[model samples]
Target: RWSEIDIDNAMWTIPAEREPLPGVKFSHRGSKMRTPHLVPLSKQAVAILTELQTWAGENGLIFTGAHDPRRPISENTVNKALRVMGYDTTQEVCGHGFRAMACSALIESGLWSRDAVERQMSHQERNGVRAAYIHKAEHLEERRLMLQWWADFLDANREKFISPFEYAKINNPLK
Candidate 1:
């Protein structure tokens, strides 16, 4: 999966090959939207990944199973790690839940538009006509800024373990 990351460009191109399919024989297929998802990494993400590169560069995969360097780390692997970190995976959160957390934070930030956030989340438009007209990479620039803001927001609140809304209330009480 690290092969999909382009640290130099601060982007992650989720390959169509990683998408899942119902009837396909191969385990991995393509995206749910049936298109490649290009995620722009924030400055914080780049920094974190830069450090990660040193650890996984030779292996060519960003994360690997503990026993097998050839295999990508499983979702359960992440869940188990989260449990060790004292997070309740069963009720509190799971690996996939991070996306929900990020989406919620992005929405609550009020710095990004709904369309930008939706596009960034790779959510498919239910309206076929609108979907046909909308650009696949719509609001990319804004999405990049939103992602950076999110990472910064997380960094700022990590020590306090407060929600962005709560942090804003304390720091910018009048706003």
Candidate 2:
């Protein structure tokens, strides 16, 4: 929901509950993990969201269904959009495929720790005892920097651009 977005802080908190009406059968819950997901918005993400706000307005929800503004968008929205853009979701990519793209880029960059990446991906801890002790803020600062780097890397190589990894290696071989 748009209410959960703190544009000033550049954070989005996905609550665990969605209560539209009292004792209504049509209420929705947040993440399937039953935990709040706090995502840090990168500069590009913020800029895009800012523009989206202009179109979407400061309404209760940022994205609404095409049929009804009050209803949340369908899960297939991204896939449909990709299809419209001439990308074959089945053969090339799916909505969740972004996770793989980001994970591969981040891991290949050799700039972030595995723990930080896992936490940012919201992966569940295998050990129940260890899971209880984990803090959401763990490596948050590093994650923010990592995300910024990723976005910058993308921007630097949007089109007719060199790979950042190659550029960095050629420019700073000592590292």
Candidate 3:
């Protein structure tokens, strides 16, 4: 039961790379459409997925329960996790907020070009190119690296006191 869904879609039957988006259909190209539609997984995503896979048991569904073997999970589960973490789920604080916070931080950090950052988040870029290309990365590998860095930066700053002033102070102490 859990021996599936290493990478699957809603039904958890097909790899996301091979399956079509739900409720949408086309000719034979439909399934093939998924290939170009993937945002490259970031190193952080990879690491998380890897750990989940291990926790999932052999062939375990990433979202399924081995003992119960039911549907993966729901937003409620996410909300519950938030609540346990003392997050204010009653307010705007929810799971997806991580993306918003990340995008804003990235744009502010200047480590990522605005376009690349949006692509990482699957958000539309400022330029019109985003409308035409959702998952087709013009620079896939570079974007992957940038995404990893973004994740690492967030982790690094999660409980840190260093600020821009500190960085400059350390790097240019003579100044």
Residue pairs in steric clash, candidate 3?
A: 2-59, 2-60, 3-59
> In candidate 2, what are the lDDT values of residues 1-175, reduced to their tens digit?
7888888988887777765733324446775467887777898888988888887844377887798776667778999999999999999998889888878777766677777777778777878887778755467777877777778777777765655456445433224
Worst 10 residues of 1 by lDDT: 18-27
The TM-score, computed over Cα atoms with residue i paired to residue i, of candidate 2 is 0.81
TM-score, every prediction: 0.83, 0.81, 0.60
Q: After superposition, how far is residue 117 of candidate 1 from its true place, in Å?
A: 0.8
**What's the lDDT of the predicted structure labeled candidate 2?**
0.74
* Per-residue C-alpha lDDT of model 1 across residues 54-139, encoded as one tens digit per residue: 78846566776687675656658879989999999989999999989988987776656788888888898888988888856468
Judging by lDDT against the true structure, name the best candidate. Answer: 1
Candidate 3 Cα misplacement greater than 4 A, ranges: 1-36, 42-44, 57-60, 65-67, 125-137, 161-175
Evaluation by lDDT, superior candidate among 2 and 3: 2
lDDT of all predictions:
0.75, 0.74, 0.52
Candidate 3 CA-lDDT value: 0.52
For candidate 3, write residues 66-168 as lDDT tens digits.
3443334443678788899888877868877877876776666544566676655555455676556654555555565565555566566678844433433
Error of 3 at 42 (Å): 4.4
Clashing pairs in 2: none
Candidate 2 — which residues are off by over 4 angstroms? Answer: 20-27, 57-59, 128-137, 160-175
Residue 53 error, candidate 2, Å: 1.8
